[model samples]
Target: MGTYRYRVQTSGFGLFLGIAAEATRLTNPPTMNVPVSNRVWLDASEVNNAFHGNRLALNEREVAWLRVGLDKVSGDIERIETSPYILISVRALEIFEVDYAEEALAPAIAGWATREFTLTPRLCNVSRDSDTGQFTFDWNE
Candidate 1:
């Protein structure tokens, strides 16, 4: 089995904070794992409920990290505008996976982002070189 990684980008820190709080409450006891870097790895089963029916295969192992950052934009007025966004990265381990991130996970996140935060989320496919361990991103698909 191989591991597939994908990323989703969306702008909505305030709304996401509420959503995360609710998710944490709904998860009850909390099945998530948090590292020193403050990255929370969501539980696959709970993710389905939190994301409103984005089904993750139980046979495969799935992990996700949510991070908040700012996007800097320079406008014609010579002012820098900072927008907050959340970056979600998902990793799935399976054999013969078929664009699970593009077809399922991303859509789920996008749906929630749009409905809750009125924000659009962008999905990107990530690939890693076996020998060099370098990562590449494909934003087109």
Candidate 2:
């Protein structure tokens, strides 16, 4: 199996992100709404492959369980295959330095959003951090 990468999006300002991949899809039937001029709420769907050229963040064991698009994930480890796994959070402006943090759980370029997906064949931080602001991601287990 081949693990793919993706980011979660939300309507922080106006229209959020949508996934439109070949096999990826929304979880269920969606409802239409016009909150203010044009608005929606809690709308979750795997629209298209917006991150087709993105990178993977997984290990050999995990990569063995990866597929192209959305596949169910069953574990949570920080780094794999020398690459780091990230656990993205609520804030949109935060970023994990490539070579600093052990793994980076960063939000997509679209900005603030909430999503659930895993990236395999992780990316390694190929830098040497010598500054104070630089932080490293670590896994206790």
Candidate 3:
């Protein structure tokens, strides 16, 4: 065919321990197998936490400096506010190579191969496949 659109995966935006589940892990792992189009998700986190952990290590001198200036920060868990996630359905052209004469108008993987999605903290959840028993499939953008 020319091009096709599939409901790769549907995720529910939620949070886990202040961290969106999808933030830690997306239904479709960010890789070639999993295309950016497959990044379908919905903002379902009304009470989402979306917490992230950051580190600021300090040496003895640094600690002493911070102590001197009262710039020391120590705590158990830090709370970070992140954006919500939305459920989205993705469809891409499955690249089919025929010959130099003919080419399909599907998801193309030519010069542009690698891609990235700037996902804030948001719990994205997609149920595993029941028939094939797959959490999700792989795609590329």
lDDT of each: 0.29, 0.23, 0.21
Worst 10 residues of 1 by lDDT: 68-77
**TM-scores, each model vs. reference:** 0.26, 0.17, 0.16
- Alpha-carbon runs more than 4 Å astray in model 3: 1-81, 97-114, 118-141
Q: Best-fitting candidate, measured by TM-score?
A: 1
lDDT by residue for model 1 over 1-141, one digit each (tens)?
112223333331101111221112122223343321222223333333233445444433222222211010011101211222122222332222322332233223333333333334445454555587443545453
lDDT of each residue in 1-141, candidate 3, tens digit only: 022121222253211111111222343333322122223222212312112232323234422321221111110001121222212111222211222101111111110111112212222223454576433312210
TM-score: model 1 vs. ground truth: 0.26
Global Cα lDDT for candidate 3: 0.21
Candidate 3's displacement at residue 132, Å, is 17
Residue 33 error for model 1, in Å? 3.4
Q: Residue 46 in model 3: shift from native, Å?
A: 27
* Winner by lDDT: 1
What TM-score number comes out for model 2? Answer: 0.17
